[model samples]
Structures are given as structure tokens and as C-alpha cells.
Target: MSMKDDLNKLNETVKQYRDELRVQMHLAQQDVRDEWDDLDEYWDKFRQKLDDIRHDADGVGQDTRETAYNLGEELKAGYERIRKRLK
Candidate 1:
């Protein structure tokens, strides 16, 4: 297979695993997953910020890099905090 095809398959595999994880999380009633899901707004914002960074890399300089990095760190921190509260 070509490199592109291989990469596409890998991407699809990763997506499938993520979907399976969501199903398992729901079945297990994992509070962390639920909280993560509820934080959709923040997640969406983060995603948009990343996309903007990619599109406008000219302005995504040092400060924007730091901001994006910190946002990701904060999100991960929040996820960890909620995870600790999980039953």
C-alpha cells in the first residue's frame, strides 16, 4: 500500500479506538469521561484555537504558542481534577 493509504488506515484505526473508548466509558459509567464530555464548550474552543493557530501561524508566534500550550495544559489539568472526583 501507498504511504497515504497507510496513514489513512492508521487514522481510521485511531478513530475506531476512540469510538470504542466512548462506548466502554459509557457502559462503565465513568465519571471522568462524562465530565470530559460535558466540557464540550471548552474543548470546542480549544479546537478552534488550534485550528486558528494552524491557519494563522504567522500570528501564532511565541505568545500565541505559549497561550495554546497553556490552554492544553489547563485542559489536561481540569481533566485530571475531574478524574480524581470520579466514582
Candidate 2:
């Protein structure tokens, strides 16, 4: 698939996981909550990057595209970590 398709799929998955975790965050430890806060900030930035890329695909550079994809992957992993901890 193309980078746009890949990022969109990743975005959806990450959002779903994030929503699930948010519901269970009350059970999370302080450190986990802190990490969540950091990831939440990152998520906003990543979403903005994704939006920029989607709106102006030709204007965005390869490096920026890669960075956004990498950030999404990291966010996915971070969400999974918190999910495991909550369980």
C-alpha cells in the first residue's frame, strides 16, 4: 500500500487502542498516567503531521513522511505497553 494508506490504517488502529486505554486509565499507575500524558502530546503532533501530509502530499518531504510513520508506530507500541500494564 501507499504511505497514505499505511498511515491512515495505523492512525485508525492507534486511535482505537488509545480510546480503549483511556477508558481504563483510572486503573493505571501514576507512572503509566505520566507516560500516557507524554504520548497524548505526541499523538496530537503526529495527527497534525498526518493531516499536513494528507492535505499537501506533494509538498511534504520523504523524511517528514517517514518521521510521521515512525511516530505512529511508536505511539502504537506505547499504547500496547500501557494496555498490558493495565491488564
Candidate 3:
């Protein structure tokens, strides 16, 4: 093949790869968003439970506190992971 024809073929190959990469990245972003949405739902439930536990000072026990603390930590870590992925 002529040099010009080879250059054209190379450019077309690069364009195809770029388009594929764009689609893959778009799908990945959507997956991440869906995961974050699911996590947010759970995070809200955990927050409510934590608030209830805090409010019930007399009923609050070590186990309850520990559970709440652990859940909060998990949510925090999840948020950090999503944030890092977005960046």
C-alpha cells in the first residue's frame, strides 16, 4: 500500500478504538452511578437508625452504638471510593 493509504488506515483504526473506549467509559460511569444510588439508599437507612439510637439515650447500649459506628464507617468508605473513582 502507498504511505498515504497506510496513514489513512491507521487513522481509521485509532478512531474505532477511541469510539469503543468512549462507550466503555460511559457504561462504567452509569454502573458507578447506579451503585452510588443503591449505597445512598442504605446510607439513609443507617443514618436514621443512628439518629434513633442517639436520641434514645436511656436505651442506647454498647452493641447498638458499635453497630451504628460500623455502619457509618462503611458508608464513609464507600463514599470515598466513589469519589476517588469519579476523579
Task: Kindly list the per-residue Cα lDDT of model 1 for residues 1-87, writing each as its tens digit.
Answer: 743343344334434434444554554455666666765455566556666766886766666555655555555555555544543
Q: Is candidate 1 or candidate 3 better by lDDT?
A: 3
Candidate 2: count the clashes.
0
The candidate 2 region of ten consecutive residues with least summed lDDT is 62-71
Per-residue lDDT tens digits for candidate 2, residues 2-40, read 888898899999999999999999988899999999999
Highest TM-score against the true fold, candidate = 2
- Which regions of candidate 3 are displaced past 4 Å? 1-28
Q: List the residue pairs that clash in candidate 2.
A: none
Error of 3 at 23 (Å): 23
Error of 1 at 78 (Å): 0.6
Candidate 1 vs 3: which has more TM-score: 3
lDDT per residue for candidate 3 within 13-83, as digits (tens), equals: 43343344444445457777676676667566666655676478568776665565555556556655665
Cα lDDT of all candidates, in order? 0.54, 0.93, 0.56
Query: What TM-score does candidate 1 reach?
Result: 0.50
Off by over 4 Å in 2: none
TM-score of each: 0.50, 0.94, 0.60
lDDT for position 27 in model 1: 45
